[model samples]
Target chain A: MFDAEKFIDQQVKKVRDEVEGRAIIAASGGVDSTVCAAIVSRAIGDRLLAVYVDTGFMRKGETANVDKMLGRLGVNHMVVDASDEYFDALKGVTDPERKRKVIGEKFIRVFEREAKKFDAGYLVQGTIAPDWIESGGGLRDTIKSHHNVGGLPADMHLKLVEPLRDLYKDEVRKVARALKIEVAEKQPFPGPALAIRVMGEPTRESVAIVREACAVTEDEIEKAAAAGEMKLPWQYFAVLLPVRSVGVQGDIRAYGFTIAVRAVDSVDAMSAVYSKIPHDVLERISTRITNTMKEKVNRVVYDITDKPPATIEWE
Target chain B: MVIDNGGQWTHREWRVLRDLGAESEIVPNTTPLENIKADGLVLSGGSPRVGLNAEAMGKCGEYIDKSGVPVIGICAGHQFMAAHLGGKAGPSKVPEFGKTLVSIDDEDDLFKGLPPTIVAWESHNDEVTELPPDFVPLAHSDNCAIQAMKHKTKPLYGLQFHPEVEHTDNGYEMFQAFIDVCQAHKKE
Candidate 1:
């Protein structure tokens, strides 16, 4: 068990002592970022500026929801509407590595501009241990390029300060709960957001399909957990496959994209076993997905592959 | 000490020990047995090939053969441990990749005070079909027969399922058991 209070106090002082000047942090409202925001706020209350960028790739109503969260925490925050910027940069990009890199570069540019406005000299991120481990270095193999680690720009101007870099997803949640943050149990969302969830070139249409499928998946899964049908997974989401499959819809041959619902249980993000969701709960997710997005997504599949062969994220 | 077989929960195993007040580090199997100095050794789970790849497993064989330290092999590490000891293991006919109910067929120091049946977490394509010489079976799941095994006299053990993961009930207790075994040997 992690002594979260001791860890928090040590980290608060560490961040305070390390950062000589004002710092700007990327606050994505996920557990990692939100926890980091809360901790840094405790360290240097007014000096820390939490920047929540509204990338068009975010989940539905995320920016607005996060805005309310930051308000409750009493942290000084700035919201940047850079969805247009991200869309332009990610045009014609299909490769997972390329997408992450583009998003990272775009984020840095936005953060750099915001840092200038706040006169902040350091950039703090909620980057945990798994972000860099899977990102690969030394003898480690690169599973995937996490936007924060693999996607960082070479010529970044601001100095970096990552307090939570050594902790894992589970430990971060413990700290979040210790700090009384509401998003403590929030599922792990990639820094690149829904862009990676859409395997192919993330267009407006493709992203829209995944966004809704993901919403339905979460809705059904949460309902199942609430009703005592099944335990909640550590992380669960819907991934939009690059290829389409053939299916019949009311006597008409309909070809639509396939959505793979991935849920896994893990103490940390390093390795995970696929969650054994009840058959009834799976049927509900499949039915609701096909019914809601009838034209866009006709086929619903469950990813039973574990983390070794297949990462939590499909990409 | 934890042998890094490139397993995903290699860190978690180490964390469990650290949280339990055990001093441990994730050391690669390539490190010579003489270079390793520790009370216990945790052989961690790794890639699909670790179940079959010798080079990927590095010098794990020598460590188990040379060192008399108490060892607990998990997942791929468990498969390799069986294979090194003249047991048979290959692609499982009914591969288990998620949480499964495991029944403790026999009890020893490892399963002390634990329930007879446990919901253990597993993620592997291969399973140990036979036990090595003198290593008796301790646990079994619906799909895998050699879910847990113990060497007759030595302080060596293997777990087909991953106890380092959260889903497995009594995971921490098992680690503490192995840790206690190591502590006893340290005094010996």
Candidate 2:
């Protein structure tokens, strides 16, 4: 029912009118932000700059994949390696909301520096309906502090230009398709990235473990879906839990952290049902994770909880 | 008009109305009854548990009593409707969230042409415990007894589960049915 073409035309005009000079968009290469970058780029042409910050918390190959994707899109984009700064800012931060806020502030600082060079006063974000809805302000209960919305620092300077604020993920995908963006159907990834995937303090070791486990989970699930063994879930990934348990490997006592494999089915992110991944697929994922990580990850559990009781992401 | 009570799905309700070709806007529950101009009204579910905190509902009771239009209450709004109309609402012994099996007890205007058993999405900490004097229960689920209800005389309805969400079966049909009710009422 959403008129993607009409929506794009209207948004481009709106952005052109609202933006006086140059603008910098926080492009994450996800469906929302990518679509947003394309829309803003069409409006202001070369005046618009897309800044992609590598938070060091991205999934394996994520930074490079995004870099190439942005280049092909023909958008004026730059990749900033703020990994060290992000890691330092998030050091010792364990609370989920606190971590999101820290990442959000860190992102703004990076964007601010880039904006200074570009002389851009306006910042565009691909914040969709669920991001602000779950972020909770006024009457709505705080479900999670999304890094883009609730995680925003009050002292932020740049004027925000959220073009897709009212639209949902499905609607955004429709727009992405209309625009022929490649990652239109990409799985939803939180702005906090791999930092939130780690339950406790996201040290280098924890981040690396979760990143590998996540890659393995994604690889197995995608293969199972492609092979017709199971239906592809709306979103799927792995979370590194801090709880460590004892196990035996090669007749040696092994103690290691746990990984949780999460997947769900939903049109919008508001409500979701746990994906009915076949036991075979789940078993494969579990074995692959434990085997790949060896003694570092002795246990891999499947999260069956729905969004009401449990959000899709562990954090 | 969709009266927003801060429910997460409040915007979803508005989106459903728009998809169904109804000119709808989300208004805060605090809006005065006279300021509302629409053929029908929907009181959206909110984080405020009506059973525990009624004052936070913000003149929703006034809208139900004074607004002359078809009204549908959802979740918190449903609880508040029952409470304001001399019924009872409280914390559910078994609170349901996410996917639920809702069985229609009556083919009311809202559930017209829908299957007997439907999949509905629920996210509620409290529920209507007792039916208001002039109201009858329309549906139920395993954990919650009164999933849906309607007034005997007034064009009033209530739903504990969310039909505006895409996960819910026949959500568009249910909303279309409500729109029909509103249109029919406007004709009279």
Clashing residue pairs found in predicted model 2: none
Q: Please name the candidate that would achieve the greatest TM-score relative to the true structure.
A: 2
Q: What is the alpha-carbon lDDT of model 2 when measured against the actual structure? A: 0.91
Q: What is chain B's TM-score across the candidates, in the order shown? A: 0.97, 0.97
Q: Write the per-residue lDDT of candidate 1 for residues B1-188, one digit (tens) a residue.
A: 89988765677788888888888788887998888998888888876657677678888888888887898889878888999999988899898866689999987999999999998877788888889999999999878889999999999999988887766899899999998899898899
lDDT of 2 by residue, B34-81 (tens): 899989989999985743477788888888988889999989988989
- Each candidate's DockQ: 0.21, 0.76
- Could you tell me the lDDT of residue A16 within candidate 2? 93
Residues A1-315, model 2: lDDT tens digits: 679999999999999999999999999999999999999999999999999999999999999999999999999999999989988888889999899989988888888899999999999999999998898888888989898898788888899999999999999999999999999999999999999999999888899999999899899999999999888999999999989999888888899888999999988888898999999989998888888889599998989998787888988
Docking class of 1: incorrect
